[model samples]
Target: MVLLLDGDDWLYLHPAMSAFDSAVARGEMPPVTLVFLPARDREAEFACRSELWEAVRDELLPLVAESGVTADPGRLVVAGQSLGGLSALYAALEFPELVSRVACQSGAFWWTPDAPDRPDPLGGPVGGSLAARLRERHGLTGLRVAFDVGEHETRMLPHCALTETLAERAGATVRVSRSASHHDRAGWRHALLRDVAWALA
Candidate 1:
């Protein structure tokens, strides 16, 4: 199963499902269920909090299992962009049993615990709280993660680069790449598909 955060917009505006089907047809990825989950309040939910991860573990996964999708519990993939991307990595770190594969695009790596209230949220740290967490944690041996950031997102690069390096250092099987556009969903669309496929592989 692939749990996609901020996926409602991606599904509606882009031909994401079609692209998935095409990739499957070409033997690029296995046939799997895609769960597009929309966040009610992105700021609160995707802030790398326990509440969001708990809801996913307790409520969402059970519902998805009840639906009888041909999903492998051991190979679950989580894909997200921006803040959603941050949340995806957070899940992998905090709930490793639930999330082991991740396809993250342009994660908000500058997010500290108190970043939302700061005058300049991105100015506080190089890679923020996540980087510190990654530095301290080293249990990512079985994790498979794909990290992608837009090539044009210059300001976001340092944070992303630092986080990516730290994740790799933590022993995750990591794949890094750059997208063509800036901090936009259009640029992330293709990377989402490609990275998910790689994660599954």
Candidate 2:
């Protein structure tokens, strides 16, 4: 399992590893090798860019493979929140072999190629660029994705809902849910663990 966010926070602030271990102890899910990856440039790296995907596919994954971690290459799960969530789905759409399963929380689906330049980034078209891409793509038959967004994030719901519908329409086995809080990570913690397990299952 690859977790995208601050590594220290994921390890300390949240009991992600402990929760996973407990679930495994209960036979709720299989044991997984957790890989935490923090973003170097939040805006640039997390954007739907080919370069970032290339680097992960080429450099980072090779390093992980060389580390002798006991992980199934074919069953890799990528979990991310907000912008990272968008990037995780991007990886699944662009490189399905590398990222077939994903657990996304509160994805910034309002991101477009020129969204940053707009006065209100979130005020752009629904589902942003990813929606447009999904409308034209159709190779997600093997993908399994779980999408969770905060219930209080009213502005984000439309974008997320459209994207979820498009992904499922394009052949991905998708799961959708809503958390109790806003866009904050604290509210996403439980969903992260639960959704990851669902994706793995």
Candidate 3:
């Protein structure tokens, strides 16, 4: 099963979401399952909150287990964009065995100026800080990560670059792409379909 977390804007019902849905209808994606995680909104102060991760750990995981979309945690994939991207990383890092792959598109890795005492707005340190923990526990042997962002996404470009490096160090197979510009949902939608297919396959 694939989990798609909505961004801070909570605009999952937009064109980008449609692109994924359309791909499924066309059989570009396999007979896959999808789950959506709601967003906290663009103005929320603590963007990617511990409270949110609590929901995934205490609530969502069990739900997925019972639903049986993926009986093996290693078959599960999680994805998101922007703040949602942060939430996806948080989920995968915290429960690596439960999620084998992560696709972060145009991720907002600049939530915190410095790593906070708690998980930052993006749920961890800027640029793959959680990777260290993953390696220590999950060992990073089977983890696969796909990261992509537009070249014009200036503020997030550095974080994206650093995150790719961190994922690699953590022993994950990482892919980085920078062919597009930051143009809302349109710029990122195509990458979502392509990366999801590649990772989930």
Candidate 4:
């Protein structure tokens, strides 16, 4: 089974699965049990914190299992876009055993601990909080992570690029790609499919 992050943003992803389904029909990639974990509060859950992952590990997975879905805990891929993407990568960094594969699209790499009311929240950092974490040099020996950012996301490129490089440096098997459109779903669908395939491969 696979976990798709940011079910609160399901509207952004639901339509895109058709594209993935077409790829599945073409035998381009294997099908996954797409379990969407709706975030009751994205800002809280997807932050660089520990509570959310604990809940996912202790509660959410068991609930899915109880619902009669067969899932291999070892093979879970957590896919997320935007801040959720950031959180997915964060999970891999902090909880490597539970999250081994990640398909992250256009993560909010500009996030800083500074309040959002700051004149330029994006101005203070290149890779934000995650960069500092990445610098810690956690050994991600068996982790596979894919990072995709929109080609048109000029302001976002530096952060994503740094994170991509750092993840690789930390020993993860990493794939980085650029999507055609902006930060919208138009670009992410391609990322969601290609990156997940690369991660699994």
lDDT of 3 by residue, 1-201 (tens): 777776323343463456667888897876566676665564242245566667665787678778775445776777777766666676666666566788888776665534444553445544544434444653576877788898887767777777677767777788788847783667667777887877777
- Candidate 1 is scored at a TM of 0.96
Query: Where does model 3 exceed 4 Å of error?
Result: 7-12, 15-18, 21-27, 42-50, 61-71, 113-138
Q: CA lDDT of 171 in candidate 2?
A: 97
Quote the positional error of residue 100 for candidate 1 in Å.
Answer: 0.3
Q: Each prediction's Cα lDDT score?
A: 0.90, 0.86, 0.67, 0.82
Model 2 C-alpha lDDT per residue in residues 1-201, reported as the tens digit of each score: 554555556877775778788888988778888887767687898889878778877887778879886345468888888998999899888887688998999999999989999999999999998999999988688999999999999999999999999999999999999988999878888888788889888
lDDT leader? 1
Regarding TM-score, does 1 or 2 come out ahead? 1
Q: Sorted on TM-score, highest at the top, how do the candidates line up?
A: 1, 2, 4, 3
Cα lDDT, model 1, residue 113: 85
lDDT of 1 by residue, 84-190 (tens): 99999999999898899999999999998899999998888898889999999886888999999999999899999999999999999999998888998888988
Which pairs, if any, clash in model 3? Answer: none
TM-score of each: 0.96, 0.93, 0.75, 0.91
Determine the backbone clash count of candidate 1: 0
Pick the TM-score winner.
Answer: 1
In terms of TM-score, how similar is model 4 to the real structure? 0.91
